[model samples]
Target: MSSKEKLNDAFSTISDSFLTECARPLKKTVFQKRICRLLPLVAVLVSIAILLPIAVFRHKSDLIPGRWTLISHADETVRKEMLVESAHKPTVSMSMNYNKLPAEQAEAVGFSPEKDPCVELFAQWFYSQITYDYRMHFSLFQKEAVDYSFTSEAIERGFTFESALDKLDTVTSHFYNGIKYDLFYSLVSCKDLTAELENTQGQFYKSIVRCGADPAKISMIVEYTFDDIKLIMNERFLNTSPDGERFNFMFYCYDGHWYIFETEMENDFSIDVLGKDEDWLSILIVPQECYGRVVAVGRGYLLLDNGEYFMTLDELDLKVGDYVHVSFTGFQTKGRFIADDGSTEQKVTCNNLLTVKLAEPSTPSEEERSNE
Candidate 1:
């Protein structure tokens, strides 16, 4: 299918999943499709805003009979405030016409195959929030990108910056039906671009973010800058080899758009690609007072430190002493099931498929192997 079609399909999936998930008891409030009902009011306001500009220009047509200047000089007295306003709301005044562009064109812009896998993933994840469902859907992941548009509106409504920040905290706990990737964003630089665009020039903000699937580990750092909606990502990949070296990835792009059409990430560690190139591992840490039957391999729950257990989605050939690695897709909480004897058990369900070697046996040490 076409790129736009694919993007629509991906959003359709997210929308459908949102509906399906929202119907569930506790999932309803997490991310409801409430925007549909509110969109009419927004549309009316936008229509009026658009019309007001046209009406003003039409009345002033006599004054500007020939040509209009695209860029105007900033008054020195207000230049600092103007710069702040420009940086605060950087999205180009003109809406990007991605629909008219070919799918390849959209893919070519800004996106590169050689880019750092982590950077691409971050870009996609960050862009996904901006595109599908607006900033509200950002709660699905560890909050990273700041919605200046929303912030601007909030400030205009007379809220203090600190209050606005607190008000934007929508996600109370990280529990949602979406990809389980965590992103921690740190603002690196916000400055005026020295090398300007032909028709457009404004302040650009650079953010250095540590993003990856594993909440415990920072896999890679992505340096990305955005001037309005145009995003450029400097991708870097973390080599899983013994050296743990990192390398710059150069993905060819068209006009430097770099936005991913779909949310399916290339570096999402949870999506298991079956082969020797696997980067995920699973191990069974047997509890000291464990007294359970070997009914199934990975068909069990992992006991959390807080006296809670996380159940496995698929069965693993996990023996007590086995240190097996497995790709973890996601999980479901309060996931309950009825046993054969009619007993219901509630637990955190893990979602993953057994791909590589079934429970690799704990091998003897190198010294032991040499002696043998």
Candidate 2:
């Protein structure tokens, strides 16, 4: 009676305890399933709250605050064709004058007397002048000039021949400040030791010379034109050629002025100098008037009363309530121009037309807002 009764009592107590624990867990499981079903709805509401602000911020229409409409050309066929032509164009090579230095001067600019001493002096001098001013330096030869001319060869290219010529002229002008005609004239008038070799018209000697200050050290470059060679020797060498490469013919800035120490030229054309990078952001500004608001610091929009006018940011330095003259391209809208005639809708030329200010910021609403 003792062993059997004790075993049965222990089994019954264990069964009751297990059933009570299972009942609590079952209830918890049901509650967790219900929460899982509602989680998606809560997540969707949270996402909506996060996206609303972004949507409102991007809602730009009619040029209103928090809304903007940018008008850009959708057809880029012309631009693409122009870009392709530009990419495939061949580069132009410029020839420098090494014979500008005579045989004696060539030895002075690190040019070996054993080698072609005549041109070595000129090459040495040219290299020194170029390396001296890295920012404004142009290689004695510009590859872009050739490249541009090559690109312009394609007749179907977007820009006209005149336009291409204009661009080339613009780029070349950046190399030197003097007028092209005057420079050419001066080169023709210069006389030097090489000029003594010229017998008559069209008989020219091509030489490069480096002549500056020191007689021992010199720079070397190549020369092809007799006039350029003579100009260098007459203006730069003081009518005398250095004896050996011991002279420093390279120009050094002394007291903010460029002074040549010595001179020489190389006979070979293998010397390489890096080309100048193009200025992409070059722009011309024109004055014009348009309606714009000083909405915030450093922010303003020039609005044209004529709906079709559009201008580039590069064309004008605009400010709030400042009257300016502007020219733009767009369609025309029929509008009443307040003139001697009271009020009559007139067909106005809008697209790509020059606009003169009829008045400054005169809208009552804009004035009230400004006061606020």
Candidate 3:
């Protein structure tokens, strides 16, 4: 028999219903076919969904132009007051495309690696600061770099600023409000620089890396003058490290701009870095006396209404409610002054009480008196 006849004889033994069922076409079910056809379309839709936001964000911050890039979108509100205008007219001409460049004073004065754009940034943006009428230092802090924020990790570890951009209020608190740094020396020099770059791998590296800015900006810079060493600390300590050097500060680049962030030299109200009234007392930053009104008094100490707690000198015999002229140095001989009542508060001594008045008190008008 032929192979076709053999197949027909075999099929004839099966039921007609089986034969009929076998004659049906072998094809996918409607539900299966619909799912298969929809998968490619769903995949295309999913791809669009994933890429849409990224495309939008990239479209916004596509480029960081130069120093101090603004992070706001076109629709975002504009900043005011604290906003620093971006300008880069290099004193030592260099390419605008580079990350770092040498500055005038930093190079001419031979600062080694300190001759960076940061120094130039300082020279132009904040020349009045280091050589400031330091008396007004606190009030000037509102002026800033591109963007600013604190690092929680650095603070939690008891390390104040590990090259992170921060506010200078704590450091500024140490300054005799309204004192200028130029009082000690007419000729100021670019003392030192510590430009610490943040690691690209760091969790806190909020850099404009895409725009070619480094993950780390700049960290610390100190300005010092040896003028007051002998007078401030006496001969013995005059041979020491700071030698009554004026200010130690922190700096960093944020949002593509530079900032003279904080003074690392001292924290008068807290546990201080430079302690000892004699160290910074006579080197007064304030042109006038700091006035303190006695709210509370204790043995060898007096508490002022402004929360100033200071140990009194043997010569300063002051009483409560007396509007005494006072000054504060960031330095303290002791971290905390223990009171007879077993209490303690940070204080600058009565020597700053303007014990020997420099000028006779002048009577003020009603407006000045009321304002005071």
Candidate 4:
């Protein structure tokens, strides 16, 4: 074959597109090289942008267990306006369907959880405590007191007031958001209770909770059970204040009466200058175990032969004569009672009883021996 005949054969084998300059490899620019290198990163960013919100939207609700409707303030934001606070704060509300609750618990919560008498009582208790409106729930329970020292401290904190009422805006805003939610878990949470109870209860007794008079028991009129109590407040109410970020006022049912048994409050600064995180919470004390003889048992009170009195939440079929071993969250609050003779007695309230076991019989106390 001649050279011309061989070239014609090769050209016939190759396509016309490949034979053109358009199919030839060209030198890439620096910008094109950078873009090529960034392709994978750009793809990853696009994926994240599309997926992150969907993941959030599909996230489950973590509100308290059970079906509940707000009966008090209609909405959290509306509730804030009613408080003594002066600042305009927008509250974020969460609606929940309580899952994993025991059947009995679900029934106890009822169709309208807010209708629980304790919830109403708690609402009144919180309002009176927050507004210092003793006139609100007159005769229902003993009124909550403010430390007069707060007045002097407010000045020390560089706050001034025309009247006592005028001071709450700055004072409350710095210390609290004036919003709260209630939850009832049959088993008490010892985690936060034991940690803060001692210091705050001590301060409370020193300044306020010391009482010689029996607190008037307010009847709910409705047969609502007051157990498994939690009042989740907006964060950063000072950890030690009487009306703090959580469980502003807690009550226990004893002798068919609702009595204020525990309280946690915000720090005095009413200012975030304390350098705590936005979601900062109270410290938790280590739990403990105790073995004792049940000298007395009532609806809300548990007393041991050893003179320890506990306001406990337990599912045990406890009787007055039983000897048992108990695992509990540590003590935090002490109810101080004054006697007519001017002597003072203190009683510590312990809760979050994780477990109770019937232990081998221990020796009887001298008091128990005498009572027998």
Candidate 5:
């Protein structure tokens, strides 16, 4: 037989066998008839069960766009009102001395005028030192924590002004609450470029921050020209080593638009990285009374209220009746040390001294001793 005829025969045989078995059961009267009647109902219930979840999901999905639109409109209204209020406030402008080096003092600091032409040479030196130190302490690119990765070289090669602007558009569309908003304003507010050229090494663009309440809070928008960017890039490359000592540059490109190239600096000085103060006397102290009435046993340590003095726990040098300040950390209480145990080997009582004064005096009502 031909292949098609063989397949047809196989299907016919299976159907005939199934029908014969079904007929045999139907021959058993009421039982067969009841199953035959319930089969159609069971099929219908199974179809509905499969389709129910899909129908519900489709219904909810249809409502999402409308819900998002309402939320967005509400947010825009609040932001508009805040911007208007912020604009009416008086703005204060203070020149931040970016270059803190004195021109006359450059000779004493071994700064050769030819090598370091900038007058603020000392400030530059300090800035470079701090920046390098911070980078060394903290690796700029934490690869383990990052979701996306790129290098400064890749950013430089891939990026163009047009591309960056396009990426900025995409960024603003998605991340309107962050840097995108700031960049959008910066581009829109780029006014006259009549400022006299100071440095030929880089091109500079500045925009006035119009949306902030305080001038100090307002950011001065500046974009370093390509040459400036290249200089910074070259310096970074030379400073960074191949042994993972360098920072990774991450760039976001949207619709062929490239955003700013940012590398995690080794030392992010903008954060607090200072160590704890070791000198006890120089530490600022507060007294226990400053904190709410001490319900349980509490201890305070010696603190230096004055900026100059240093305090130590050495019993050999410090004695009872010596004037000193004690500060307890959590309680926010600072007091003068009045008395101490003469022996250095034992635990001393600093709380009972007369010289100790509460940084914040308790209200007289709370100060009254309760007659128990």
Candidate 6:
């Protein structure tokens, strides 16, 4: 009935209540403890589920939906040596006049300066036209007249050899390591240019103007840098001197991110444009469904329609004079094509071939042949 008696009673009651709560179900207590232990893992899984798509999208930034390969000359010294071997090979002479065509051919083709804008542009503005006669045995296609002329305006505007070198100095001044400038240079630089060459007689000299970009095909994206920089080069533009040498306006986008495309020395000493060591990489834009007919088949490459050709890795079971349709789904170059020049460091050229099929050749009837 005193204060001590009350305090003792209250302590006993509190101790009993605490023990009773601790003696509750052990299974429920263990389950709650397990959930608490897994909380960090659950949070991590939830975060990954929400961010996986964002990570994938970031990885694929600046990737265009097509395929292309990176090419670089490992050794310029080897290239120069190969050039020496190519020049002494046998060569034949051929000529073409853009201003005037043969009477019979002119009647059928009708590419007069009055009717055709291209013809008129070349004839009225351009001064000289030259032809490139191949001296090699490997013919991807029949030798067509490789000729071009430049307009006076394009010549005046195009880059000269000396001026192009000067522009190269100015452009490279802004370059530093890891700072990408392919797209920036392409946007600001002048792509077309002119160069001088000696005549065939080795007596006189001439200047070549520019052909400009082809309206049919705008430009080809060749180099895609690691920083997602794309270097676009316009379709092949060409000029020629009185001698049988070619001057090409090529965008040197790989090593030198300069604007003034340089002139390449294309002559008997030069490798055939289709042979092995051409810089520009072409995309198979139009499939056979668009327009392709096989005319001839060779070891590694096939001839389509007339001049078009595609190389394959494995030898196709195709034959010459077979009419067929070709289709390409994608582009891929796996292995390297080793040149016979005996270089230890071979070139890494891709075998990006189109998946093609062959069909039975259609035979023309006697009447059809006679009509032809």
TM-score of each: 0.19, 0.17, 0.23, 0.26, 0.15, 0.20
TM-score of 4: 0.26
lDDT of 3 by residue, 1-372 (tens): 999999999977998888888797765332221100111111111111001111222322333332332233354522111112122210111111111223454455344332344334332323223222222333222232111222233354355542322223334333322111111111123444332223443222322343244444444433322121111110001011122333222344444554444331112111221222433433443323466566655433455656554433333455566666665442222222333443433332322222322232334658998999
Model 6 earns a TM-score of 0.20
Instruction: Return the candidate ranking by lDDT, descending.
Output: 4, 3, 1, 6, 2, 5
lDDT of each: 0.26, 0.25, 0.31, 0.35, 0.22, 0.26
Cα shift from native, residue 115, model 2 (Å): 26
Model 1 agreement with the true structure over 115-200: per-residue lDDT tens digits: 33323333434433322222323332332322232334445666654564443332211111121111112111222212221212
Error in Å for residue 230 of model 5? 26
Best by lDDT: 4
- By TM-score, the candidates rank as 4, 3, 6, 1, 2, 5
Model 1 score (lDDT): 0.26
Candidate 6: where is the Cα deviation over 4 Å?
1-293, 305-307, 328-353, 361-372
C-alpha lDDT (0 to 100) for residue 101 of candidate 4: 31
Q: Report the C-alpha lDDT of model 2 over 15-107, residue by residue, as the tens digit.
A: 677887777656432321110011111111111110011121121222222111222223321100000001112111112223234545444
Across 1-372, the per-residue lDDT of candidate 5 in tens digits comes to 999999999887786778867776554333211100111111111111101111111222223321111111222321000000112111111111112234433333333323321212112222222222222222222222111222232245464434433443332222101000000000011111122123222122111111111223212222111000000000000010112111112222222332221222222221211212224312213222221221111122232323111122222223323343433322112211222321122111122111333334433444465532
Candidate number of the best TM-score: 4
Candidate 1 lDDT score at position 209: 24
- Summed backbone clashes in each candidate are 17, 74, 14, 13, 18, 4
In candidate 2, position 358 carries an lDDT of 30
> Candidate 1, TM-score vs. the true structure?
0.19
